[model samples]
Target: MSQHHISEVPVEQREIGMLAKHREHIIDQIDELVKRTKYLELLNECQRHGLLSPGMCQNIKEYTPGRRNENEEDLLLERHRQLFKKLTQRGPRAYETIISVLESLDCKEAANVLLSVDSGSFVSLREANKSRRPGMTVVDEGVTTEGLVLSKVSKESKYQYLNPNEPLVPYTKPVQNSKRIVKKSDKCHEDAVTGTYPMCSQYNRGVLFMVNIIDFPNPGVIRNGAFKDGEELIHLFREIGFTIFPYINLNKEQYMRILKELTSSQYVENTECFVMVLMTHGNRVNQIDRAEFHDGSIAMVQTEIIAHFQASNCRKLANKPKILMFPFCRGPEPDKGVETDGRSAASPKPTAQPKRNIPTLSDSLVCYASTEGFETLRDPDTGSWYIQKFCDVMAEYAHNTSFEDILKKTQSLVQNMRTATGHLQTGNYKNIGFNKKLYFNPGFYK
Candidate 1:
């Protein structure tokens, strides 16, 4: 062979005019093949052959073992022969006419003819080849046996075929991230105490209520001393101006009632934000006690109770910052401690069962004591790692920083503490994002 060095063309500016022209030509050929008159004639022929109207052909030309290299002309001719044989044997006038029409087109014209005819009918010729029978091949004039035409049918075309799901255009716009501003009417009160109140109300100056659900009925004298640490948390929130509501040994119904009242629009509307603290024994999915307990447990407050409140009454809080501090074990036991460690041994059974019906809140922050599939640890002397750090960070940062900033500080503190104590597994839960921005002043400065 003579040495033939072909010049490589830049794909971006390569000559596609020929391809475009060929495409247009093929399209025109298809247009002529699918003329209404031709379709009517085919339909008449099919009717004469005792066949119904000539419906759209789903798989006209397919690549097979022997037909892999077949061009449009060859395929069209093959289809004509197949249809003719079937029509003659079955007596479908429409099939006979369609075969005759298809036979008249050459390879270069066959694709356009079929496309135009189907385009006129309810069938879309541009739809994905997957929708057609397997082995079906779509080719342009220049498309070789190895080349394939990717067809995509529009919804409008599908609708013409009686597909209700298909539409001419997308009914919904693309979802885009947009900034949201959270509005509040309250101002921080100078008389409010520090370190106890949630920072959300400091900037907004709203009434705050802190509810602590402690399931401990009675701890041994030594354990009892440590359990009293939770009482300090209660006192802190109260001194900071929050109305303290402690639900001790509360059942499902009682918990629901309290949550209903707290989240009710009637009450929540008067406040700039809401804060809920759940301190109880929990497993991976449920909150349980020694005996039987509520299926959803503390989480029910958001999903079932709060959902009810928001849906029926408290639409105002729908967009407000609803903060939930969940300090509970979420999963199986932690690893055994080293001999050098002097901490108490792990309990035989989990302290509590998982809450089954916990609900998800749309516009809120859920601060878990531990990450998913991990257990939450309590100091017995300082409450839970999550709660202590959370309260401490809020008290330290509430006066000068935003709620978002406080969360960041809390997360850092928890990570540091976990690392320092050799409990690297005790890291903070993932940050719960919000759709809107929230700013808070803890009232420590004011």
Candidate 2:
């Protein structure tokens, strides 16, 4: 793409035009030195009020004769310098005008220079410098003839007082560097998505609980790659707006106790949602078992786990969203080899299942790594296939997209990935028991 000269574009359209281009979007970033918008108006006011002499105004007007790119930038820098000088002198109605012009030009550095040299900060110093003792000379104290006061000099005898924060020199405008626009990673898209809704800073959003098991007493049952999965999930959830509570290497009894406490009214108060991330090893006995603690070997029922957080059981979370993610293997059966022709078949479109009339689990969304009796795939370098896809999809499209839509995309993406052994793996979303369609406020967070 060809680079456009700054002088060719109108001031207002500069940002918009740069954003419209696909390749040069980073050029729309705020410039260090902002060009003055009301240069003629300020010049006219200074000349009429005699704040600046006619000769000084004429010199400013004739600083640069041409509208070339280099010359225009140079003229803008000079105007900023003149404005800073006038601001120091405390000209009538000049502070408001200069501040407004700097804000309009998006000149943050120049604005800082103006605000740093505040009028109020100089009043005391100016008065002190003008007040001198009648008989106190440099030779009277242990001071030199160059007006350098000694440390023993009294506060009243000091000639000059300067605020260290304010500098006498004008701030030099920095040249714009070609900073590479950082794109979101393939495995995790943190801030890639853009939307119109403002981010709600009230922080009424809920809490997230990550239950990870990395160490097991039995050396044979080592969860090598599970720790990375939990770390990534914590970072991802926290970024989108969830207060994270990481529970690592907990036994069965401790897990239940924590869950019970979280479901209570005191813990769940003022929370909009709850997220439970479980990463551990499981067996055919229908329970997650990995570590051996003081309270025997860890073994907890999956059905009972979800049932404990039901609306009837946990009244505080009634009518609120509860997300449950399980990234561990459900069974020991790995995907076996299969021979087939290189032909693809069209899959049927997904349809929403009809709501049940009987009493059922409510206000909960549960996800599993694989279907029943199948083993899930995990990459040693990256995390599980299901979790990586789920996080990436949620990060990029969760702002405006529904939670169900994000899950559907994650499912399709995970299903298309093949394991290192040429085995296909798929994730299952079971027990989606919410009454209405659920959506996350990814647009708002802490």
Candidate 3:
């Protein structure tokens, strides 16, 4: 390990080459450098010096929260690791630029932290041939008959889906070498940026409670392609690290029970976010926002649905993102097609701190497939335009963009969408209690 010291490194390899080899050491010292430096300011200084590329900046920004875990001690270690990895991939002057940037930012300790790494040392490798676990395979449709006694019907059933809450091989000890290897670990800002909520991938990512209503008793229209929407949604959110619990054709009692279970579940307690997606027929009755259940009973969106995750009722989800998506009608009318006079489409992003004393419903977002008084259009073969777009945008941009911005993009796509009759359907949302930004950080930990 002593042979890898920075003092013994060749001058030519000092900053650039040694960076790649010594990255683990750099990560090892993360707790130190971050203890003395302002991480974002470091990024800014690096960018200002033309040392960090825009893509790198966006990647780091998206991976690390803008606000959460910002304290000196609890600093995000991966942020520095990512920056170092990018720097190593850079050209000749990468070393001088970062060192200068560190000095300019009054982060001499951070600079020294880099310069002090023992580059000659290499971490021990994990056993290349460890016993394989019985892993369950995930498919696009989400329903799998593989991996267990029940799966004897198919070759895919040889393994079982591992529950994360359950300990994996209880006798196996976790590998704990900070100076082992450079671990692997997105974009920002055409729109206004806000403070990002901390999304920890160390444990649970988030919980998704989805109810897809395709069947209703009596004269109600059986929502065609609704299951497609639900299937797509389940697939999409699982990528976001959500523990998906999906229900189909639930009556009012069962729907209410789902809500009750979610609110009272231990999963929400440690989750970074809680999302509820409802695909069913809905309409405004006496100015109340309501949607139909399997039995055709109406659910009060605000009181019954949103109220469940409010800080007052579910304290466990307090200060966390509670995203409620209603891909259904809110009123009886459709948004008539509007002729835009012209087609078109930058500001320096502003970073704002989340204000205190917000509201009982803080940290929640409500997404409506169509604006009030408009009918949400759905395709018999596909699904609703709003939800399909929502899935698409999130899949493409959630890595580097804020959830709010993703929603905005989804809405923008929905606004121009015309039904078969040439009527416009616009997606809208209520941004309640969101003073900060939210990044999905898809597949970061995995």
Candidate 4:
């Protein structure tokens, strides 16, 4: 006879069962019609924000205890539990309302009830509480994924948190000035409806411009691993709704020209988001190296690249999410085999230039594979550790999780990975200035 061992159940699961059992008691506290209306409204809001699919909404609408099969009903309830969990994490007012309703019904384990519904939701709920407003009404910030703060004022009439001294720029659509001459080249990009390729297709959620530089003038610095990175990214981004545009082996002039052209492309105007992936050799000063087949190697400063997409420059893509992924060496220093014997001699550094501000360069994210003055590792078979973990985590959680949350998880995953030589790779994320929670609608391309 085979012996079966019964393991101890998790505290969260037990709590969930307890909450489910007392679901009726909580329901009794709220007016049935009002509760139903609120639930429906929440679902609609979720749908509008790309958090829930049409099929998910339909499933909720048709939910009945015995009408559907047992398994189907269980799945439906599980989805409901997920929704409740997400609300707790990202919806401050809804979570507060749920907790208040439970407490009013004399449920002492209100926190347990929330944990039971969604195990990983406790941290999110705690974070939400930190920024909760005084009133009960939802205050949509209109930018971030963490939905409106609770307030007495209605959402439309509610004032945003702004500095009293700085003059505010009202969010408005861009209009063409009659006196300004429109250049023929400025009217770029093929018509989406008539475009044949996926990169130019109207159905795509966004454009992914990948620049891969493999062969350098120096044999030691040749990026044999870059092609693999491109392949991996293409597969990953496609699943997440990006139309991939791979530009490989471009010299310095060609790469710069292409980037400048893309900034003014009509495609940027139509796309919901923009992604730029750079897989190349770079320096500590944030300059990417390019192979000049005829002349030699040249460097392109990272700021010059980013400036092309600035608000004053690329008006069409202003305020939209711009994600830049750089999987390259920030410096020549290796991670391992450093000499601890003696103090190193200090060297004179180059003088830095004065910085100019671009106010419109908000809503951008820059992901660096390694920090300044360090070298990141790459796998010949797979790809860079950061990119691989980033794609994996994004593929699994991008649909429901906020980009910030997803990136945090990816950072954690990257930090946990160790190389064969026992050297660990660490990545850096710079949130340029995104106010809204960025997300790709699940099954958008499908």
Task: Name the candidate that leads on TM-score.
Answer: 3
Model 4, C-alpha of 397: deviation from truth (Å): 1.3
How good is model 4 by TM-score? Answer: 0.48
Off by over 4 Å in 3: 1-193, 340-358
**lDDT per residue (tens digit) for residues 132-243 in model 1:** 3322111101111111122221111111111122222211221122121122224542322222233444333343433333322111001111133345445444434444
How well is each residue in 89-194 modelled by candidate 3, as lDDT tens digits? 3322344445556777877777777666643322211210122122211111111111011111222112222222332211111212112121112322223555
Local accuracy of candidate 2 as per-residue lDDT tens digits, 1-446: 44212111111110000011211211222133224234565455434332333323443554543456666657766664553333232222333334444554565555454445444422221242354332221110001111111123222122111222332211122212212121222221123342221223346456777676544433222334445566566666655556666665666777777677667745467677788877665433223422222222444445657778766777787767787876655543444446779898998875766654534566677887676655565543344567767776766666555666678777777666553334555677764555445545554444
Per-candidate clashes come to 23, 0, 12, 4
* Order of quality (TM-score): 3, 2, 4, 1
Candidates in order, TM-scores: namely 0.42, 0.49, 0.55, 0.48
Q: Model 3 — which ten-residue stretch has the worst lDDT?
A: 139-148
Which numbered prediction scores highest in lDDT against the true structure? 3
Which digits, one per residue and each the tens of the lDDT, describe model 4 over residues 328-400? Answer: 6564343433346677889787464433664557778887777665556554334456676666666666554
Give all candidate RMSDs, comma-separated: 29.2, 30.1, 27.3, 24.9
Between the candidate structures 3 and 4, which one is better when assessed by lDDT?
3
